[model samples]
Target: MPFIAPWTGENVPSPAAMATRLGRAGYGIGYADEYGIADRVRGALWVRVPVKPGAGGPLLGRIHALRQRQAMTHMLCQGCGQPTVGGRADQRHLFLTASATGRPVAEGEKTVSPPSCAGCALEAVQEGLPSGRRYVAVLVEHAVVWGVAGIVYSPHTLAPVLRDVGNEFTLVAYDDPRLPWTLACREVVALHGCTAVDLRDLSERTPA
Candidate 1:
């Protein structure tokens, strides 16, 4: 099934489970020094799962779970978890969407979502997903590995510090020195050559 988040979908919570003293990759709920990411530094924006923990666990979405898996393993499609890239420039993966129809997708667009095969991209458009209508296709011409979105912990205590007033964690880039100490969940990729295509139009041109 398509990744349907609870916020936009039914009353379903996240389909993941992780419990520790400190949050890991911003997905679970924990306390001070519990989440051990890596060697951390002070003053850096890290991306993480924002959890206000209710009864069971923090309310996480399916997309969040899928993203974590994608980060660890490269060459996987953000759309279907299938192998998209074939280790060549022309064989690079795609980040399909419908946000920019008839327009060119600019570079430097950060995407936590995974890559997609051409067939899956087309199917998503035809089948339709949560925000599928406006999300046009996005081809990742150049996907340079960026840092992750995680939480920034206290240098001494190792507890996640709230940078923003109410925000749980922040976006941490891989270039930051404190990257090792942050719990990364989503795998972020810089999108290039985002080509917006209209499926209906393409279908007409095809011989099939």
Candidate 2:
């Protein structure tokens, strides 16, 4: 199973679970039973979800918050949940992402998608691209935890800010003031020293 896949047993948490919690940073959203460091990422509050893997079939395109965070924090492959860099401490990790312009992955690009191992990179490139869009692969020398993608709550009203009609998530950096009021769903990382890889060559080494 994919590391970030959401199982059927993992239901979405209701908005009623959120309440205003005042701290040194000011008013932020928190659960009634929220723990200090455990419930936060980089001082930003994260959404809580139950851990139940293999409860049912994989829910494609949906993410389980905790699993996503785990894969990202440990640099595990989104495909097989194994170490993406393996034991090569000096080797760069591989990251794949969709590109509308068909350009190569660039340095300092922030992405919510975690790194993929060589075996899964080929599968992703073969099956993950949308109609007309291309996918790009890059070997990243550094993948730094930058921020998160989550719901931003109002500091005053303590309600979620519906920025647009359908946009429920917003990217907020660690240093951004709005982070304090946000409930993170996925961890975002910035890729540095990226070198684009050709999928044709990558497929050659993929296991049969």
Candidate 3:
């Protein structure tokens, strides 16, 4: 796929445009940090550019460049510090999938890409099991209290952990009518409670 600059508002750029930009700017294209969805649910791409010997690029540009090249940026597992690869590459193992029904449950279609390495993916899968537990618990608690169903986690609270731990969870929601305040509360609690469990044993064992 050809690269399109988000800043330019180009939805999709042709190969010629991409090559033109690359030649002019000497930028190498791969995948950007902002391209993919968490846990590989959606595909993403990163671009790398070599700055001129002494020509300093904008801070954002430099940061983006560095991020594109980071090992973790491309399926390097944060837990075991290993490159997730082969059949062991299960991105869903690292991301949590939200329940479709109002009742909280575990399991979902694996829409995301797995890690690039086995060891890293194993640790991620272990951790995701606990995360799924917490996620379901929070959802059930919210439903019992407020009688609403949907993704109940704030991105602000969830993003940090999601980014740190890995994208093993995908929040989903129902279209049933419910109070906005109740829905908000569910999301807040879900985000906060998911990470409030015993960190030491979360990945050591499955939730009872």
Candidate 4:
């Protein structure tokens, strides 16, 4: 894909329009003491013109820009931006990328994308990606926060900064330094106690 999962034709506030705005006003998130988790958790924010992102634009738009945290914890659907809590507690909801085959979801594994609803998962498997990257649905009871995906800026200057050593374009983590301000783009979390399920299995079931 051209756009990320949430940025697909489904989500609102066109990426082209947002990109156009960013181009005109310059693309860079501001430094803040803390970022709102709910904003990034849901794909309800996007960039606006003159770089004056709306209420949730600054952080949420950055998240959307990188296509990172399209979904949040507790089986939040990456496709339709809804809670996919599933019918039973043990059997929640899940949607996996092809790379998730052998890899084990450890206690602190980082997840860029979020879970998908049964309907969206099926839609993806049917005609989501042009390359046909296989995605799997799963049942999970819980998850935990890991970190975030955003640019680190200098609080004094409010300019996006990067690791001094490695790639000049690299960003720092949330717990790095106070000077290197962190603007969270993605709310990463680790999936716990998951049980893989087929899309057909969820056909008769969905999150409430």
Candidate 5:
């Protein structure tokens, strides 16, 4: 059988499952040995079960919906202590790079201008500006540790930062509580360790 996520078009299947399906179908050599279409077909069938309409779709759809919800929940800004519903259209938030001494440097400052609302502007000020040295350091460290872009949160709104930073800096949200703290540790380790953070191990250790 082949695995398929009907709603999202994602594929899923185990090697053993693929082999068994191919063998039962009278296919030779088994999918595991060849790693060809036979294997893909089997995997797709495994996930996209031949069930009634709307059966398998819900599973993938639900996950996507949850992610959307998380994104919306974190869009609010933390600065100005209010939602960014009526923020200026021309204003933007700026994020400055920090130096070795932990002080914010203006050499490669990144700006996120025309924030949709005041909340977003405040979040940029507190999380990206030079005044927020400690917060920026924590966010950068977390990104390095996770082998991903850094995460920023809105203090007043408890929302995550969602925007672009720069080529070297990627902006991400703190949707998961533990993710922020974990990234902070990884950043410190990255300074000394050659290996990147193992996402699988981190997932297993943390709870959703």
Candidate 6:
């Protein structure tokens, strides 16, 4: 199972007493007892989600914030929860993603998906790569912590601002001025020095 995959038992708690606070730039969302040192990341307030992996069956399209952060920060495989790199000689990490354009992944591309180990990569191919999605695999020389996928809130009303048409979530960068008011859901990373690889070729060379 993917390390960052959310289970059915893990769900976002209701915002019973959720509140906003004064930030340096503007008002930001938070709980009354929420600590900036613990909850805020890159000046953005992250949404609080329960951390209960394996409490139920895996939630296919959802991600667990804490596990996703850990996997991205430590270069752990999203497929099997193992380290992507083998040793000092193996510095490059393998990242697999669904490409909407059907083009190979490029350098300086940003993503929230974590890296995959060789074993998991093969398994993913055998399993058909998540239904109808088109996948692109790459060997990333460097994956940099970029920002986050979050909900931007209204400073005046202290309510979540509806996302723009056709957009799922607001992507806020660490340096953005509006980051303080955004409630982060997932950590995002930029893939650098990417070399796209064919899954079939990779599966052929990799042993079972």
- Backbone Cα, N, C clashes tallied per candidate: 27, 0, 25, 0, 24, 0
Worst 10 residues of 4 by lDDT: 16-25
Better of 1 and 2 by TM-score: 2
- What clash pairs does model 6 have? none
lDDT of 1 by residue, 7-60 (tens): 232333542232233322333333333333421222222233433213233234
Residues 65-132, candidate 4: write the lDDT tens digits: 33334346444565566665643455654645544343434433556667765666666666644353
lDDT of each: 0.49, 0.83, 0.25, 0.45, 0.26, 0.78
lDDT of 5 by residue, 1-208 (tens): 1011133232223323223323333322222344444223221211112223234344421222222222223322222223333232422222222333554323222222111132232333344434433322111111121122333334344343454654332332233342322111001112211122222222211111
Ranking by TM-score: 2, 6, 1, 4, 3, 5
**What would the per-residue lDDT of candidate 3 be over residues 1-208, giving only the tens digit for each residue?**
1010012222223321111112121322222232223212111112223323223322321122222223223433323335533222222223223233324333232112212233333344344542333222211111111121112222223211222244333323322221211111012112211212232333432223
lDDT of 5 at 54: 38
Best-to-worst lDDT order:
2, 6, 1, 4, 5, 3
Off by over 4 Å in 5: 1-74, 78-86, 94-102, 105-208
* TM-score for candidate 6: 0.88
TM-score of each: 0.55, 0.90, 0.20, 0.51, 0.19, 0.88
Deviation from native of the Cα of residue 108 in model 4, angstroms: 3.5
Compared with the true structure, the alpha-carbon lDDT of candidate 1 equals 0.49
Off by over 4 Å in 1: 2-61, 64-67, 86-89, 97-104, 129-133, 163-169, 199-208
The runs of at least 3 residues in candidate 3 whose Cα sits more than 4 Å from the true structure, single-residue gaps closed, are 1-46, 49-74, 84-92, 96-201, 205-208
Question: What C-alpha RMSD separates each model from the true structure?
Answer: 8.3, 2.6, 16.7, 9.7, 19.6, 2.6
Best by lDDT: 2
Q: Which has the better TM-score: candidate 3, or candidate 6?
A: 6
lDDT of 2 by residue, 27-122 (tens): 778888888888986888988787888887778878889888988999998988998665344578888887778798777989998998887888
Which of 1 and 2 is ahead in lDDT?
2
Identify the superior model by lDDT, candidate 5 or candidate 6.
Answer: 6
Q: How close to the true structure is residue 89 of candidate 4, measured as C-alpha lDDT?
A: 56
